[model samples]
Target: MADMQIDSSPVRTVNVTRYVTPLREGGSLPAIAEADDGFLYVLKFRGAGQGVKALIADLLGGELARALGLKVPEIVFANLDTAFGRTEPDEEIQDLLKASVGQNLALHYLSGSITYDPAVTVIEPKLASQIVWLDCLLTNVDRTARNTNMLVWNKELWLIDHGASLYFHHSWDNWAEQSLRPFVQVKDHVLLPQAAELDEVDAAYRAMLTEEKVRSIVELIPDEWLTASASDAIAADRREVYARFLTARIASSEIFVKEAQHARKSLI
Candidate 1:
């Protein structure tokens, strides 16, 4: 994997000291692990179910989330030494660690945070609107009511587990065109009902997501994670494809904004 520039600096690298436990499997093998820095992190593996692209989405989604002025935990590159897997007794986890030895993604753990439950909690409308707009732009498919993928640690919402966003990259078939496809799933988004100021949120988020910013976030993906091969007809440079997809999506923000607004109307 290649190095990526994050926050105007090369991504800081952490070494995994111990693999504590695996989170319940879904799209990828994420685990709670202790790191050399004496912190616990949720490690998303490249060798897992969704593969490196999921890590790419994780990095891109987190970067773009911060760009939109949303809260996300600090993301770091974790260098997994293959030796650590030898200590693991679980066959499945050991295999995952061996395959993911080189470069993986880690998120600073939130100790006492609980999953956001809309029934028991409510986020402000403006914040909800911003989150809705952000998810729609990335075509995030995992933010529906059942999953939510959000945390409330200290009376504030934080975003997490974005590997399921940017679903277009899973297939490179006319990927640029796919970028322009409307996020029809936004209607079912957990936040759409509370996205009170769609127009205002759209305007602000649209202004914030510049082409330069999109490219910057895309560049944050490690080069090895840029897996579109010469064999793939749609992209030789996966980064540019991601950039085009992002710019196209945001450039057509009005369409999805209206999509969310329409969804909101139906919801209320």
Candidate 2:
């Protein structure tokens, strides 16, 4: 998180004006839709197989990346009307749209961007370290060689599809304990071999992501999204849980940092 900058600007809200096409590449079946703002966005449906928890992960992970001065697509809250996708021929997509009629999540589409091919594109150690560190902090398990959830937009790396991050929330049984554990998945991170600056970035990132800042990022999650996932847990209580977990995790960054370093040693 060197040269750290926090984008505290609240996420914008948009209305989905049209459902252009579905992006079948992602298992969630996210689509490219045009919003009232006259921009194309990759819409992540609430009714997707992963459900609202995935939306929550997207918001948290994307915003946290932004907060840490990483390159991430603009995220927005999209409202889908009840009659949005009725005319569609596909029953599965139609039902998906119907079920996602309320609020959803979307990333401002980066047109003309190409998927990051590690073999062709080279990443400097610092940038690679930053990405690896961010994923470790969030315990993200998706950024692998097979499906590197990264893009080369404007010849720079842009992270996307964070719906698979923060997986501990899927079964909130031991979230607190899970937070302090090392992210063993860092070994498989697409950028691990290039992430030679893990130790250099760890302290700066931890200092930048203070408890207040972490809570602010967690608070960006919509109340309905939290309540939808946890019928028994109050939204406020859940927010605090996330805040505490992230804060504790950051405080223990040394643990994961060491693990990532060890993994990198094995690679080199």
Candidate 3:
């Protein structure tokens, strides 16, 4: 198996100690785990169905968000020893994975403490606008208003779950016109409380991201997740779109604050 070499600067400060508990399962990878150092981390392995590509997407996406200064959990790739091998679905580990679907990845076992109601998410309009900006720049279509995959901890909204994104890479270029569509119009359809602060957020994003870092992050994706030709095409398209989006965002220093303001007034 190829080892994922994360840039030492950004993630070196975080330490992943021991595996504490199993979090969730039933996806391409195994459940997340709690590290003995009192931090939450996910444990993944090379499996029969999914390959390194899935892991690559997760890592690269998370890293990109971190670069853009969004609130994201610190993710590190860990080698799960044989002791953490796959167990039966009825096994405790399998049960943990099953229950973790759709929640924030950081709180795997803490699901009981939180509810999944969209109405309860603490996303303000400004924050929602920034998230939409992230989605557009990454060409991520999975962050719909209904299934806003976010976690609110300590009154802050954190983003998660980029597995379903870059969907165009799965087959053909289905997102050609998506960029030209009216993203501002749909702003009223979601919750965003932080709309007035778009300039501040944009400044932070500009200061943190760079082309070299973006390329490095995307290149880290494994070949398995993009095994087939169709899969490769999807990944390629997504990469191109993302590159263009990032370049434009950086040059313009633009923010979609108006959309968020609309969403707030409409009570989305």
Candidate 4:
């Protein structure tokens, strides 16, 4: 599974050589940092309030989107050094850097991108439905009108900030049953009104996401992120749990698709 490839490319890894400004808008305090590749990336620290769980969500959700032919910034493994942020003056930022001195997750920074504005930008029904379907599949509760978590770059909609997706993992209980349930939060989706093609795109999207593909994405999650949590077997088995949960959720995507369609009807 370690050699598995999505699009024949695995997520690349980079060393965080410089700490840039922090993106304070996020509760997790993700930063825009420079990597050893000489490219800038939006770093999602493993030591934030959401910890490694959020990073896992980011990786899983982003890769799932990419698998479905959506535009997501390139996700990467960011190695943070112990002495990375010693020069920072702020106490809070300093501590965050110190605790996050290990493997973290990051996305290629989309420079000069603007947050998606629903009032101005009009998305085609198919694309809108696809994005809505994706949010439903991930049970993402963050794509509300208040916080779109989307960006308009080069006149295209690119997804970002999926750390808020797969919220079920935060509690880590009854994951199987949770995967079978509907995503009731579909009602709050920003694109629900325009996602009129939900029914049309359902089958095609499901076909695109195979169990092996999902497991490959799950396998991308580092062992440290899985084992860093609990002392119990649940921690050791976390990766398998994620793979099973996603495959189950994809198998039962109709439950959430119907939920999204019904929610869309209400909006119109």
Task: List RMSD in Å for every model shown.
Answer: 3.9, 3.4, 7.4, 3.6
- Ranking 1 against 2 by lDDT, winner: 2
Q: What TM-score would each prediction reach against the true structure? A: 0.92, 0.96, 0.57, 0.95
Order the candidates by TM-score, highest first — what do you get?
A: 2, 4, 1, 3
| Model 1 bad stretches (over 4 Å) | 1-10, 25-27, 228-236
What lDDT does candidate 3 reach at residue 175?
46
The collision pairs in model 4 are: none
- Please write out the lDDT profile of model 4 over residues 1-268, one tens digit for every residue: 1121235258888999998899989898999999888888899999898899899998999989998999888889999998899999999999999999899999888888999999999999999999999999998889988999999987989999898888878777888999999999899999999998987788998888888888888888888888777756454488888988888988988899988888878889
Q: How does candidate 4 score on lDDT?
A: 0.88
How many residue pairs of model 3 clash at the backbone?
A: 16
lDDT per residue for candidate 1 within 71-136, as digits (tens), equals 888799999986888978889888888888888999888888999999999888999999999898
Q: Which pairs clash in the backbone of model 1?
A: none
Considering only N, C-alpha and C atoms within 3 Å, which residue pairs clash in candidate 2? Answer: none
Query: By lDDT, is 1 or 3 better?
Result: 1
Better of 1 and 2 by TM-score: 2
Query: Residue-wise lDDT of candidate 2 within 88-177, one digit each (tens)?
Result: 999999999998988999988889899999999999999999999999988999999999999998888999988888888888889989
The regions of model 2 sitting more than 4 angstroms off are 1-8
Worst 10 residues of 3 by lDDT: 100-109
Count the clashes in each prediction. 0, 0, 16, 0
